[model samples]
Target: MNTTEKVQTCLDFIDQRLENQAEQTIRIAELIIEDIKNLTAGYHQAMRNGNLKEHSELVRQTQLNWVNQLHDIILEQSNRDLSGQVIQALQKFVSNLNQTQMQHLHFELPSPVAREYDAQYQYLSQEEIELLMGQQRLFPDNNDSMH
Candidate 1:
């Protein structure tokens, strides 16, 4: 099959799965909504205590945790229900592509080995550092040397 046909077939498969899982999906959504309501209530109580500045940080952190949990739940569900089927379909799709078509295609799959980086590394190139220093010199009024 052509690329478009293959893609449409995969999408149709996903749509069918979604239809079958509609009830479960709705229940999961309701749970997420309830959690959001609780978070909002806590935020309001914190606001009323007149310690909003301090409490706001805590509220922000809690919201981030909730979002992360929601992401994990969705990923887990997708892996459990769809990963194998999707992998098989994709393998067939790639196998069907002609040599020229395959040469033109590019993919950026995640690699566990690529995750590590030097935290203390400098981000700016030498040219960028020089350009920034030049810009600083142009704004003499705001220069630290004046102080």
Candidate 2:
């Protein structure tokens, strides 16, 4: 597929997966939509400059942005499984672009090992003490562990 088609696929994937109407999700969705628009403009400029012939360069760049953003979100979510899937999707998308368009793309998949260092803490979705009372036993006492 060309870059345009590949970009659309990645955008569709993000829209399907992350376009939740929640406040935070909506903000992210808007950011991604704007990024896509910027990428489209970049591609048009590149084509005009004769740096790219196929529209796939734009698509690849768009997918790259998604993968990069997904890495950040995965870090925030600490969801290893989902992060791996995103990496795989990015790899396949890049490989397809490279093989089909003869355009080499460079990207670094987020390292889970690096991310794990920050995953040592607990992040709560809600501040309700009652909901957490029963789960107290599952965590170490912060006061005792500090030293």
Candidate 3:
């Protein structure tokens, strides 16, 4: 795609993410609200019965459960990184766009060609790695959707 089209694609992806986030926020609020209602009812019932021991135990357990729920929510957090390999394609597109813009602005100089294999700046060779490891023929392509 052309630069403009490529940028639009990335922007569209970002916009969809924002929309999904709004819906996700509402869903989480609904869940927490239900949880809060149940906790409140339990607390009130214990207080009405004048059961100090039961009330205290319920409060402590509620605290622990709430914290565990928070931890689970945090662990399940999502975004572009976990979505797919599109982030890599988007980054590459942006780099190319910047390079093109720099060339048009007459600021970027030609890069020097490497004469020797520089391990420090080496690109990954998937085939070689798998062959050396004597493993499965391929890895799952997370780029399926993007491509």
Candidate 4:
């Protein structure tokens, strides 16, 4: 198979494995493994096509570029609501990455959240909860069909 097809194949296998795992960290590890697999596959494909021989220099450069390109995709975090622990784990992974590895890939660190919640709720300032039914002020008009 070509590089693209091989990468997709490996990704499929990793995705299936992720489906069985319940832990978020395990899934992330699988994703990292999948990236390594794809990069290896790309190298193998280049060798198979005899392209590596005709352009040895080009092949080396391309391999470096390809590895970085693949890393870029794996580093992306889709959910913005991840907890602090999860974010820290990902950051550690990025920090430990080799210099060549991060050339093409970049990690988007999750925004930090408040470590503790305030004991006092803001509702106390209101003094009382009003149960005004059919009150025009609470519920605005102009209802759309979309809900």
Full candidate order by lDDT, most accurate first: 1, 2, 3, 4
After superposition, the stretches of candidate 4 with alpha carbons farther than 4 Å from their true spots are 1-22, 50-147
- Window of ten residues with lowest summed lDDT in model 4: 110-119
Instruction: For candidate 2, write residues 101-133 as lDDT tens digits.
Output: 654556543555535656655445456665687
**Candidate 1 on 34-132: residue-level lDDT in tens?**
867876787788778887786677768767876886787688677646865775677576566655586888964344333345444446767999999
Query: Model 3, which residues run further than 4 Å from truth?
Result: 47-58, 64-147
TM-score of each: 0.32, 0.28, 0.38, 0.21
Q: Which digits, one per residue and each the tens of the lDDT, describe model 3 over residues 1-147? A: 986777878767875885686577568767778877877787778778888688778778877876886665565455534543565676677778888887878542232333143434554477887685664435535675477
Tens-place lDDT per residue, model 4, 1-147, is 964456556555655544444365456567657756765676677788876665556556656765775564345333222323454565455455545566879764332322134433333222243444436556766784347
Model 1 lDDT, full chain set: 0.70
- CA lDDT scores, all candidates in order: 0.70, 0.67, 0.67, 0.53
Sorted on TM-score, best first, the list reads: 3, 1, 2, 4
Off by over 4 Å in 1: 1-31, 83-147
Question: All candidates: CA RMSD in angstroms?
Answer: 26.7, 26.7, 23.0, 23.2
Model 2 TM: 0.28
